[model samples]
Target: MIFAVVGPSGAGKDTLLSGALAARPDLRLVRRVITRPTKAGGEDFEGVTEAEFQTRLAQGAFALTWDAHGLRYAIPHDQINGPQDVVFNGSRAALPEAVRVFPDLRVIVVTAPDAVLAARLAARGRETVSDIATRLSRAAFTLPDGIAATTVVNDSTAAEGISRLLAALQPVRA
Candidate 1:
């Protein structure tokens, strides 16, 4: 099964997933190919130039791809073909395409209060104040109708959030 974790920026998706993976050795985390510099951190990703990204896209390297915040991101085909239960950071807007690719996909939406999100983003120091504000102002996205999804609030400690996520994923974990 493929579990796609989607949420607003700074909502602790990566932190939550990291903790979950550490505790659940059976879960596999998929590394994404991103157009951001390697120094910029959040999730573990393979950073590449825009030109390189375009070249790989043309070469059919990605199973799913999308653009957000002026950068492009992709999931390689091999990452989703494995037998293990895989999880990766994903975009809500791309869920349909992801579902089409992995029919048994489950979406895990990690969310937090607006203030918590803002504070977390500010602490990351990745984006400018203006950029953080823009991200905070962006409206929430709803999952496409009929798609299976679970919402886990990560407003507190990482352990709490990971527990919630793990509980939600319990039924599907093999």
Candidate 2:
């Protein structure tokens, strides 16, 4: 199964996914390719220049790709294949395309209260106040019809979030 772990910025998707992977050694995490600099810091990703990114895109190296925050992100084709239950840091908007590509895809949408999200984004210190506000104001997304998804709230401790994620992914692992 391919699990697309998705949510808005500052929803702790990376943190929760990291913890879940630590506990579930059998699961595989897909490292994404992003146009952002490595130091930009969120998920561990392969950072590349725009020219390099486009070159790969033209070569059909990506299974799925999307643009956000003025940068391009992609999940390499190789990572989505194989029998392992693979998890990728994904965007909600790209879920439809992902579903089209991988019929067994499951989406895990991590969420938190608006206040919690704002606070978390502020603490990151990677974006300006204006950017944080813009992210906070973005509306929540509802999974499209016929899409299989599970929602996990990560409003509390990292352990709590990981617990929820693991529980949600348990069936997939089987």
Candidate 3:
């Protein structure tokens, strides 16, 4: 099983994912390979320059790759096989590929009220007001048409969110 966590910026998707990861030892988190300078708080997974990423892509070093928000992300095919469930804090562009590759894929979209998002961004103090406003202005994306079984509206605290995810992962008994 693979779980994809997605949401707009300032939606606390990362916070929720990280919390769930800490609690779930059985869950294997897949780190994304990137072609951008590592940000302060991000996990650096084989960072490379844009040219190098392109070269590697041409060499078939990536399973699926996509460019979004001026950054590139890739997932090597070998890193994903296993019975252990996986979790990803992936973008909207990556979700489809994830679902295609993993048979029992679950896509969870975390969201908060616009005002709540704005306040969370402000509290971070890393993003300028303009940056926050720009992000807030971007229209939120709905689940892709191809992926119908989406779980939406995760507005609870991080702990609560993790509990919800754990429950979602459990097998449904008839």
Candidate 4:
């Protein structure tokens, strides 16, 4: 089963993903092929320069890829081999291809109030208020309906958010 976790930047998506991985050993978390270095509070993954990423793409190394925040992110095709349970923290723009490729994939859209998201991003002190505002605007409308989509509002502590996420990810019984 494929599990795609996507949300806007500064929505605490990475934090929730990291916490969920730490809490659940049964799920294998996949690293994304990013065209930039790992950010603070984000997982360390194999990073490639834009040129290298292009070369790999030409070599058909990616299962799915999309550009966001002026950078490219991809998931290697090998990572989705078979029906192995997998989790990925990615951008919302990457969801459509993933759902199409992995029919049984489930998607989680982590979210937060615009104000809260802005505050959290500001606390990080890495982005300007205007930048945070733009991201929040994008996050508000990123959820798509075709895939099984679940939104977990991150207005509370990370622990609280993770609990909600875990509950959402649990298999539903018929």
| Regions of candidate 1 where Cα sits further than 4 Å from its true position | 172-174
Candidate with more favorable, higher TM-score: 3 or 4 = 4
What C-alpha lDDT do the candidate models reach, one value each?
A: 0.88, 0.89, 0.74, 0.81
Candidate 3: tens digits of C-alpha lDDT, residues 1-174: 777777778778777777777888888887778876665455647677989988888888776677887789887665567888877777777777777767577777777778878988899887899989988886277676778544545576777776776676665579
Better of 2 and 4 by TM-score: 2
Per candidate, the number of residue pairs that clash is 0, 0, 0, 0
- lDDT order, best first, reads 2, 1, 4, 3
Model 1 Cα lDDT, one tens digit per residue, 1-174: 789999999899888898899989999999999998888876789999999999999999999999987899999988777668899999988888989888888888999999999999999888899999889887377678878788999989888999999987776646
Q: How far is candidate 1 from the true structure (C-alpha RMSD, Å)?
A: 1.9
Worst 10 residues of 2 by lDDT: 165-174
lDDT of 4 by residue, 8-115 (tens): 777787788778878888777887888886653357677789999999999999988989878888889887675557888876776777788778888888888888
Q: What is the lDDT of residue 67 in candidate 1?
A: 90
List per-candidate RMSD values in Å.
1.9, 1.7, 2.3, 1.9
**lDDT per residue (tens digit) for residues 63-145 in model 2:** 99998878899999987778788999888888888899888888889999989998999898887999988898873777877
Candidates in order, TM-scores: namely 0.92, 0.93, 0.84, 0.90
lDDT score of residue 100 within candidate 2: 91
